[model samples]
Target: MGTVGITGDDGEFHLISMWVAPEARGTGVADLLLHAVLEHAGVGGGRIRLEVTEGNIAAERLYLRHGFRRTGVCGTVGGDRPEFEMVLDL
Candidate 1:
């Protein structure tokens, strides 16, 4: 199974802490998780935001496929892992 979380602030939702167990990956779990989040976001102004680590092509592609675009914002996790923000405006 997989899990994803979302929080609302201002007029947008922020996606955080998404994960799929290694053994359950590649089985559409990610898509399901994202779908659930998107469905929940429908009641919250239809905007969702998330951050992905730099070089995480799979995650980035997933977000992109779901209509998320980069916001040009950059930051780091753990003081070294580069990350950037993406937003989906439903």
Candidate 2:
């Protein structure tokens, strides 16, 4: 299990910082977490958004499969890693 962020931003819900345990990979844990977040976003009439490192193709694919389209690119807050900003309409 991991933590997923659900916060209010400008009256909208935001989903972020979702991660799963290494041993839980491929066990649908991430999918379940994402679904829960999406459900919460829908209830709050907000879109779901997240950023992932460009090199994390697996995560990108998973987000895409869940209808999160790439919107833009964002720099890591304190690091040099490049991240892709994605959003899913609720």
Top candidate on TM-score is: 1
Q: How well does candidate 1 match the true structure in TM-score terms?
A: 0.93
* Reference-based TM-score of each model: 0.93, 0.85
lDDT of each prediction vs. the true structure? 0.90, 0.80
List candidate 2 segments past 4 Å from native. Answer: 9-11
Candidate 1 residue 89 Cα shift, in angstroms, is 0.6
lDDT of 1 by residue, 13-44 (tens): 99987999999988889999999988888765
Name the candidate that leads on lDDT: 1
Candidate 2 residue-wise lDDT, 1-90, digit = tens: 766877776436656688899989898998998888877677756577778887899899889989989887677845877887888877
Model 2, 86: alpha-carbon shift in Å?
0.3
**Model 2, poorest ten-residue lDDT window?**
7-16
Instruction: Evaluate residue 57 in candidate 2 and report its C-alpha lDDT on the 0 to 100 scale.
Output: 90
Q: For candidate 1, which ten residues in a row score worst on lDDT?
A: 38-47
